[model samples]
Target: MSARIHKLIVGLTLALPLSCGGSDSDGGGKTAELTPGEKLCKSLQDYVTQCGAATPCDTALVQDCSSIVDLLSEPFMNGVSECINRGEGSMTACLTAGFGALTPTNAHTGLAASFCSECAFGAPGCEGAFFSEDNPDTAILGKAILPFSDSLVSEVSTDCATGLGCAGSFLSCTQGVIAQRAIPESTVQCLVDNLTGQAPPPPAGQETCVVEGSGGAGGMGGTGGNAGSGNASGTGGNSGSGNAGGTGGNAGASGGG
Candidate 1:
């Protein structure tokens, strides 16, 4: 065959799918449009189905998914509302922070410790189930719970920074706010101490130094400093405390006018 004819045949073959509009096996391959809530619910349902198929029959997983969705409905709605209120940038930051906080690596150990103490007051068996090491149900429950927890946290982190109360799932919301602000470990402990009516001891060892500005004193050039730190003094403040420190003027010699 001539080279031009060969190329033309190849092009025709490639164009076949586009002309036919994909496959017919999956009902003509027409994509069905879903509303936002429907789409979200479908995704959740698909995840549960896949997990169930892969793992053992987990009654707890079903219950956990149901409970989490129910518990999180208000919070999720509130989060969406808050995100809309804050504009895209802040909303994106809040969502990113919230998701980051919920990752297995960053899930708050302190908040986990306090789960039973504070969260149990209203969440019924959540504290017990969440804290119990022996519970096989926890894994499924944890996974199911993560979505709502993360959503609540994201909403709270966004809203709270704007001086608004997050409308649902207080524990997750508060944890999220703390995480988003990148609150210091000492400050977390201090808050915990205050909750329990105990005095918080100062952070140990040499006080850490925090450089100021959007990216420290060097702008983007400086390494991102630790969240909260002290200078030469003992008064290290919380990271992202939003408190302005005293501005330092240029140093002068004794002989200078």
Candidate 2:
């Protein structure tokens, strides 16, 4: 790598520990350890800086000079070293060429998130900046996560819709079977008696029970609850057979006197 690129990468990686909530004391919390992948990422960052500073590089130089750390596996580092030994261009040119090939794609979400987090913490004026927004590493992180987000959202929506439809149908069918079983007339009479017992008795002078429906209880089957007048409706009944059975009890037409 070019000296300038190496310098840039060193600056970034060294700053990362401090930027990512790391304290000076080793005893306080977990001491952060740099991983091989992280080291590679920093190395690639350095290469990009060097190349960008150098003259506009040829596409072939960019393609051939790509770093194993950035483009391929750790094992590819051997091949990368061989290419560097060949000395096709200045270190800056080779670094630039390799850096260009490490274009961000959604497969590297973790990498993209890491870079964004690092930038937000380390880079100036990066607070609240999204991968879509312009920043120092926009080209890198944006290319990685944006396409991934789109595909993931689409997949989740499709899966959720299918699951919801299946669950709703199963619930409806199960409730319908339960409602089909007839209840004994005695059970209904017992429910009515219990309900009336819970209510206050009529006054001694009052012979007939005069049901007075209050405005608050209007359209609520004398349950003394208000039906909401707003755009949002009150929770009245379930969508399945439970609703049908509840409504049938109140409807004189459905329940023969």
Candidate 3:
């Protein structure tokens, strides 16, 4: 099971470069001028934005949002590139296109939609998930996310309906449940502080998402046992002896005979 999981991780990492956008675009070449939202969407092109509907985004482009490591990979950046390319200078359109590109399978549409809705509009005091009150691009992004929010949350998880709030950090919180991993509170706070368009916070310990461990059913080998020391009496003894000895006399055997 461990080997299979490792293989899956490796396969995802290796296969991403081919199907996802490559690392070359991560550098600040042309993307320097884009807004944070635009940049994020651009970075995550292959993931499906829509699910549940027949005309949903492409399944192949959908990403496994379970691991932050995988989420931040080049494929995500390539998604940014694709988003930017698809946007043609409109940041909201780019993000919308980026989000719209993915089409999660029927089984995952509920999960995917829940995540999208939360990431988009669930954060508190942040005007929806991705935009702050001061963000100038809200007019464009805000409108786009509204209807998308409806579509995004068309399907919901049980816990999702209850926790309609962000865990302080929009991206971290959404990715946490998506990955089924838990994000440390400290980590969530730190990520929220350094996120795009936000001022940097004071130095802090690195935060992380704890991936769940896998367990296997196994049986332990049994060990051999040692003989206990005991005394053994002789059945035969000297005939007519004082102690009722039989034809053969013998002392009681000891030391685990």
- The candidate that wins on TM-score is 3
Candidates, ranked, lDDT: 1, 3, 2
Q: Show model 1 residue runs off by greater than 4 Å.
A: 1-19, 22-67, 70-105, 108-110, 113-148, 153-257
CA deviation > 4 Å runs, candidate 2: 1-86, 105-107, 114-257
Please state the error at residue 5 of candidate 3 in Å.
52
Task: Report the number of backbone clashes for model 3.
Answer: 23
Q: What TM-score against the true fold does each predicted structure earn?
A: 0.19, 0.18, 0.22
- For model 1, give the 10-residue run with minimal summed lDDT: 205-214
RMSD of each: 21.5, 36.3, 25.6
Candidate with maximal lDDT: 1
**Can you write out model 2's per-residue Cα lDDT over 101-126, one digit (the tens) per residue?**
33334434443343334423335433
Q: Cα miss at 157, model 3 (Å)?
A: 4.1
Residue 27 accuracy (lDDT) in model 1 = 63
Residue range 66-180, candidate 1, lDDT tens digits: 3323323333424433332333222212222233233331332234334434434435565446534366443322332343444543444344323223222543445445445
Compare candidates 1 and 3 on TM-score and give the better one: 3
Q: Which has the higher lDDT value, candidate number 2 or candidate number 3?
A: 3
Question: How many pairs collide in each candidate, listed in order?
Answer: 0, 5, 23
